[model samples]
Target: MTKYFRSNVDAMASYIPGEQPQHGTQIVKLNSNENPYPPSPAALAVLKNIDGEWLRRYPEPFGGEFRQAASKVLGVPSDWIVVGNGSDELLGLIVRACVEPGKKVVYPMPTYVLYRTLAEMQAAEIVEIPYSEDYSLPLEELVAVDGSVTFIASPNSPSGHLVTTNELRKLASQLSGVLVIDEAYIDFTEENALVLVEEYENVIIIRTLSKGYSLAGLRLGFGVANPKLLQGLFKVKDSYNIDAIACAIGTAAITDQVYKNACVAKIKASRNQLATDLKQLGFHVWDSQTNFLLVHPPQKKAEYLYQKLKEGGILIRYFKQPGLDDKLRISVGTDEQNQTLVKALSSLL
Candidate 1:
C-alpha cells in the first residue's frame, strides 16, 4: 500500500472479474456469462462505417445517441436514462452518489461480489443479507436494513434464480432510501421491473448490452429511473464516460430489435437444453432464466471438475466462496461447445 493513498483505498479489496483467457479460439469458454453469439449486424455495420474525423473530436458527454435509441425501445424518456462505460461504472456511481462514509449500503450475499467492494471503497457500512438456503431473496431481512442504497440483482449471478416483481415492489415500498435493481441478465427472464420506476421515485433499474446484445467488448450500460434521480447520477458520472464509436454502435444495436430478439431466442433454447442434459448426467442443476446453469456435479468435487475441464480445454466459472464451492456456473455456449463440455464431463466422471 502507498503512504499517500487514502486509508479506505489502501484497505479495500478490488473486485475480481471473470477471466478472459489469452488463448486464441482453441478453448471452449463458458467462464464469463458473455453471449456466445455475435452482435447485431447493424452494430457491426455502424462500426465499419465510423469516419476517422469523428474519432478526432470528443464524444457526446451524456451519450445522447444511445439514450435516444434506448428511450425509443424501452418506452422511457431520454432524460430518464443515464449511460455508463459499463454496468460496473454505473454501480460505482450509484454508491458514490448515495452512500456517504459511515452510511449503509445493503445487498444480498452470494450475489455479485462487486457490491461489497463498491461499499468498501466508499468507507460505507455494509449490510450483507444472506439468501435463503435455496438461494432465494431474503426480502424481509433486506428491507429491515434500510440502507442508503440497496442493490438487487434479478436472475442473480452464479445462481441464476429470479425474484418476482411483487416481492421487489414490497421491498421498495418499505425502504427509505434508493433501491437499485441491477438487471444485467433480465433479458433472459420473462419479468422486468421497469414499471416500478414509474410507480416509485426511489427505484432505479439498470440494464447492460453486454449480455443479450452481445456487446461486452463495447462496454455499454444504461439506467432508467425518475428524471430527478437520473439528474443526480449525471452529476457523479464522468464528463465523457462513453466514447463516440460506442454510442454509435450501441444506438445501432438497440435499433435492431429483430436481430437481437433472434439471438436471445437461440440462447434461451440452448440454456434449457443444457440444464436438461446436465441433469440427465446425474448433476443437480438449478433452473436458470439467465444464459448459464449452476450445477452440482454427481461424483467429483466442483473444484476438481473446474480444474479438469480447464485441462481439457473447456473453461467454466467456479467461485471459491463459501456457499458456491459445491456448484459450477457454466455459460450456455453454442451447441457444439456445450456438447464438447458434456462429453468431457462424461469421460472424466
Candidate 2:
C-alpha cells in the first residue's frame, strides 16, 4: 500500500532556487537577482549590537517594531502588515489560506515558478496564462479564468518587465477572487501596485527587503492588504514568523531611507550602463525596471555562455524554459565584476 501522505504532497512540484555555486573566490555571481551591494551601515550597526538575550528569547509574535517601520515606509497601516521569513513564506501562506483542494489558482507562465509550485502543493488546479511577446499580462484572459487567487509579479522575474497599473486595476476591480501583486522587484521600478490596495479589498501586495536593502540573508518580507485579507493569512502562518535580529535589521533598513535610496540610485545607474554595454556587444538586451537584465548573447547558446562564465569564475542566470532558451538573466554586479564578465564573454564570443 502507498504511504499515507496527502494526495497533494505526492504530486507537488517544488520550486528550484537559483544555483548557489561555491568554488572560486573570484566568482562574479549574477545568477540570482540579489543585490550587488552589502547592507547599509545602519543594518550592520543593528547586527553588531546583538546581545546575549537576543538569541535566548523567542522573537515577538507580532514583530511590532518591524511592522510599524515597514508600515510607515510603505505608507500603509501596521495592522494591515504581516512579516514573514521571506516573501516566499508569505506566498505559500497566501496559497494555503485562499485555495482549497480542487479550486483553481491562476498566474502568468514563466513567472517566479513558486506560484505554480505552491498551488500544486495545496491541491489547487493550476491555470497558467501566457504573457504576450513583450511579457505583458494578458489582462483580459486572466480575468476570464475561474480561480480562488491570481499571482502576478510586477517587473517580472527572468523577463524584467513591469505590468502597467491600468491593466492591474482592471483585473483587481473585475476579479471575484484575490489578486496578489508580488512586488519583490518593485524597488527597481518607479511604480507599484500598493496604491490599489486601498481601493480593492481583494488586492494583496508582497514586498521584500532582499533586493534594495541588500538583506537577503535577513529573510524579511511583508504583505500589505486589507485587514480582512491579512486576517485570513494570519490564521495560517507560524506564530512567530520572523526572528528578532531580522526584525531589528529590517526596521533599521526601512528607517534609513537616505542610505537605501543612495544604494538604489547606484544600482539603477549600473544597471543602465550594463544594459547599454551588453547591447553594444551585439547582444539583444531587454528593457528592465529591475536589478537584472535579460539578454540574448551575440554568439554561442545561453547554456554555453552560462557554463563558460561559471568556469571562468563568473556566474549569470540562464533558463532552459521553452521560450527563454536563448536568453541569460544577468544580475547587475559591481562595475569591476561586470567588466570582468564582459571581458570573459568577449574572449569566448
Candidate 3:
C-alpha cells in the first residue's frame, strides 16, 4: 500500500464510522446519532422540484444559495460562511491549510477521533490533553501548546458535554493559532459558541445538518468564521465542492427552522426519558447536552451487553479503547426503538 504513497499514509489507520445495516426491519439502529425523524417538508419539496437542467451545468463555486440561507438563519453575512461536503470535509480542509509536516494539532480527548486521523494523514504532531474532572475546557493546558490549530468538539461525542462559551472565548484570546469549534451536536444543547466568531478573528465554528435537520444523506455541512479567515479555505477547496441539489435542499431545510426545531425538541425529550430508564437499570449515565447518552453499565457488562444487543437486532456504539473501553454510547432513538434496546439490555442483565 505504501510503495506508491507517502510514508505517513502507510502508517495511519482509517477512521471507523458507526455501522449502518442496510437490510433489517428487525434492526433498531441506535449506534449513529442520526435524527430519528425525517427531513423538513420544505427540503423534500426542493428535492422533488429540482430542475434537471440545473445540475447539468457546474454548481455555483462556493454554495451561494446555501450560504445566503444559512446566513439569514444565523444572522451573519453570507461571505462569512464556507460550505463543505460535510463538516468532515471542512475539518480536513482546515487541517490541510494550517498544518504542515511535524506541526502540532491539539484537542482534548477522548474526542471525535477524526481529528487524530486527520493529523496522521498530514504527518502532524498531535497533542491530546485530558478533559478536566468536570469536562470543562483545559484552557491553560491547551494554550501552553501553541499548536498550529486546535479542535474542540462542543457537546463532545461519547461524553455529551459542552465547553462553556466563556472558557472558549478566553482560550481563543490566549491562543496564538486557530481555534476550530466543532458544533455538530449544538442543536441539542442550550448554549453555543457562534458569538465567538464575531469576537475573535482566529475562531472557526463547524456545523452540520446531519444531526438536527435529518439530512445526513445529503452530506451538507458548513463552517462559520470571519471572512478574512476563510480565504485560505477557499484557496484549497474543490472548485465545485457543493452540488446544485444540496444547495437547493440545504436552503429549504435551513430556511424551514420551525420544522427543524420541532424535531430537535422531540429528540431532547427522548434523551431525558432514556437517561432516566438507563439509570433505573443501574447504568451510570452522564447528563447529556446532545441526542445521546454515555453510560457505564453496572457489573462491568458493557462489552457483553453490546454483543447481546447486536444479536438481538439492536446496535449501539462500543469503543474498545483506553478510558472508554467500559462505556457505551447510545443514540437517542424513537420511543419504540429505545424500548427495544432497553428490553434487550435488561434481558441480558
TM-score to native of every candidate shown: 0.98, 0.97, 0.98
What are the clash counts of all predictions, listed in order? 0, 0, 0
lDDT of 1 by residue, 103-199 (tens): 9999898889999999998899999888887877788888888999999999798789898999899999999999999999998999999999999
TM-score of 2: 0.97
Q: Could you give the candidate ranking by TM-score, starting with the highest?
A: 3, 1, 2
Better of 2 and 3 by TM-score: 3
Give one digit per residue, the lDDT tens place, for model 3 in 1-349: 2398788998988899999898647689899899999999999998888898987899999999999999999999999999999999999999999999999999999899999999999999999999865787888899999799999999899899988899899999999889999999999998999999999999999999999999998999999999999999999999999999998999999999999999999999999999999999999998899989999999999899999888888899999999899999999999988888888788888
List of clashing residue pairs for candidate 2: none
Note the Cα lDDT for every prediction shown.
Answer: 0.91, 0.88, 0.93
Query: What residue runs in model 1 are displaced by over 4 Å at the alpha carbon?
Result: 23-25
Ranking by lDDT: 3, 1, 2
